[model samples]
Target: MLIVKNIKNTIKYFIIILAISLSLSIQTLKAQEVAIKDIYFHTDISFEFSDTFGADRYNHFHEGTDIMGEQMAPLYAAVDGVVSYMVNPEGSWGYAITIKGSDDYTYHYLHINNDTPGTDDGNGGIKNAYAEGIERGVSVKRGQLIGYMGDSGNAESVGHHLHFEIRKPNNEPINPYNSLLAALNSEEYNPEIAKELSGTINDDKNIVSSSESLCESNTLIKMADYSTVYYCGADSKRYIFPNEKIFYSWYDDFSDVVILGVKEMEAIPLGGNVTYKPGSRMIKMQTSSKVYVVERGGTLRWVQSTSVAENMYGEKWNTYIDDLPDSLFFDYNIGEEIVST
Candidate 1:
């Protein structure tokens, strides 16, 4: 009788282990299918969303989601990509930074504080990174610090928070609340709030038709003296347009640029400065407007052009430039001076 009981116990344990393994495998497959894990929280706070994607604003439909946080809180990259557009329009999105993700999605971080001045290239838009070398065409990694949270633009009186949006490759706004929820990976996620604001959960299927004809139809237009490229995607009779400038001329300049990889460095908080210990090697990255010393740290930091030259490069700054054959260089200007907050 005792031998029979031991055999039954062994069978039960085997069944339990098999069930657990199967459950984990199923979850892993689901996560892979969604592709939502690439998105992340814009700020360094809890994933509490104050406003949901597709929520109704006063005049127009709220295309993005809002997260409330303290002013000057660091904003991070939602995915690895290049800085696409940095604009600080008056009485609107305030200081905005848009990054084109490797997956072709454009992530927008809006309503940042107006700390740095605007430039001519940005059409008098506010600064995105505190450092000089951090601009259009600059490569950034996931979770890298890009800006700060603030009530810039129309949110001056509203409160300190971040207005975040995720756009399709064609520049059409997709509901990001689901993506945010997936990023949090929390059990306490409030589906009710998302439903109240967006009117539907997991509504992408309803918004875009599965027909291949609708997905493949696209039209391109050149604007801003051919410096900007606009892509319009057709969803049956309706066309999806970019909320802001999508592709810029400077992107072509990346062909001549060589990526400098650095490892084991520490980044200075608040300021976009990075520090390296003795025996560290540095590389000079020159854009059309400014130069940056690329350092290998926890995160890449583009130290100010002059500061990097003086401190890291010293006298060899000019002579020690990276040698890439047939490299093309161009000069670009920033926007007008920024107005004081």
Candidate 2:
């Protein structure tokens, strides 16, 4: 009887292990089904978003996928869908396109030159469609030639590339890279991608070859808080500047906290010549445009006010000190606040 009981116990353990293994295999297969639209060589051109964008702050999460391509690389429709709504709200997206997929998801294409030809009913094609929509005000369809690629709108500083976003039925953005994994023939390139830069200083110098080769040696610099400063030349090679004391910090991804000043220093006005305290913590960029008073005692808290030096994305900050002064300075100015607040 004891021998029989031992046999049954072993079988039960084997079944449990089998179940766990099967579950993991199913998840892996699901991951493999993601489709990849285009396979561009990954270069440290400074803006390839990863699947795990905010791992350090909020554990792990990503919003979109960026395809590396030339200025006007044609973006094909990943799947058939109807045009939903198109808007050039702030001209930040240059000319933008939005499509609703059969899967009840909406795909957004931002930073296009203008609508593609043959989109409208002929009176106004892509141009008229947007114009009419703006006049009459309505959402527009899939497969419509919304616009061509151009370095327009807010992404002007960055190189000309398409900013594609996938949203669920409820409009939550998902990582575009993962969405295309299953549909492509080539395996996803997980190796580090880089760009090369090399040029000589000369007046009207004749060039032989503009680009050399894309390799893995491209050094990446994450410039937030107070990281490192990199210099790029016409040669396209990036050389790191050492001995520069840059500062960066890690904070909660969803925290609306802004650093007012170095710990124990009086709040400085915007545009005023200022200096940091001995132990000041330089502030990182955030999403909102308001200057906030954050008092850090045993717990950290923030009070939003109007006292902002500049406005970004149409958000204005202009108020006065309402909270008690605390230690640490946040240097998140220069009009690049993260907009997840």
Candidate 3:
């Protein structure tokens, strides 16, 4: 009986010690911070969170954090890692680089002017040809200059910016803003998830703006001062909100004005006239005068000037049955042909 009691007491003491050790281990893990940058990461440009996520517009989530910067800004490596995924494809993220960190965290850097190696990111887009330089197959250190910033993607009006993303092993996008706070301060910070923009779909075929539904109680939609007036969304509603970086194709002065990912051309009848089914590959640009169209299929590119491009940005998630053109197409007139480099 004495031996059994002693053994039981030993086991209990061992359990208590293990619990204390585990608690200390967790505190150590939470306290560590990787020394990264010396600048206050601003959220002015592309980092603005919106409801657009692939095809599921309303229910989907924002994928990455956009780092607004001047054209050709230097993009530094956050931590020492090799390029795990390097996709040189065009569109929203023209030339993107994904670096795996030592702590098993993945960091994504997009809108690059060039990649280190001559290897293709396998997307095979237009920006691949613009490849200027890289330090291919070499292990890069933390804060190493990986690439330069450029407007290398699909959207024309978008200034040069870096679309940064941090993901876990499960491939879900973790908000970069939360991490930004820690880099701003040495402690590890928590990220805030954006609230979903919700609204009811009426049976009378009526379409309402997401802002009108998502707008806080005291705020109201107002026009910009001494700026261009325009109409948008399914109901052909005119909007002019200053200080908002809303980008759309600006065709000629006589043409129809349409906003990307706002409302379909078919919804307003005057905006996007043509529509493409979901998952189809198409390239479009809004110039200062008119809209240009391009279609991608196994890499043969051609121009269609008069053809009103169908739903490119908006398909499954951005749908309005009462309107004509889908969210992808932009309703605008062309003044001159503008090509992106």
Point to the candidate with the largest lDDT: 1
Q: Assess each prediction's global lDDT (C-alpha) against the native.
A: 0.47, 0.36, 0.39
Tens digit of per-residue lDDT, candidate 2, span 205-293: 11111133221122222224544333222233333322222211111232332222232112211121111111112222244333332
**Predicted candidate 3: what Cα RMSD to the true structure?**
21.9
Error of 3 at 252 (Å): 60
Q: Clashes in each model (backbone N, CA, C under 3 Å)?
A: 13, 47, 26
Candidate 3 lDDT (Cα, 0 to 1): 0.39
Q: Give the runs in model 1 whose Cα sits over 4 Å from its true position.
A: 1-37, 88-92, 115-132, 186-341
lDDT of 1 by residue, 155-264 (tens): 76777778888888887676677787765552221212222222111111112222223212233323223333322222222221221211111122323322221220
Off by more than 4 A, model 3: 1-60, 88-93, 114-137, 186-341
Residue ranges of candidate 2 with Cα displaced over 4 Å: 1-62, 88-90, 114-146, 186-341
215 Cα displacement, candidate 3 (Å)? 58
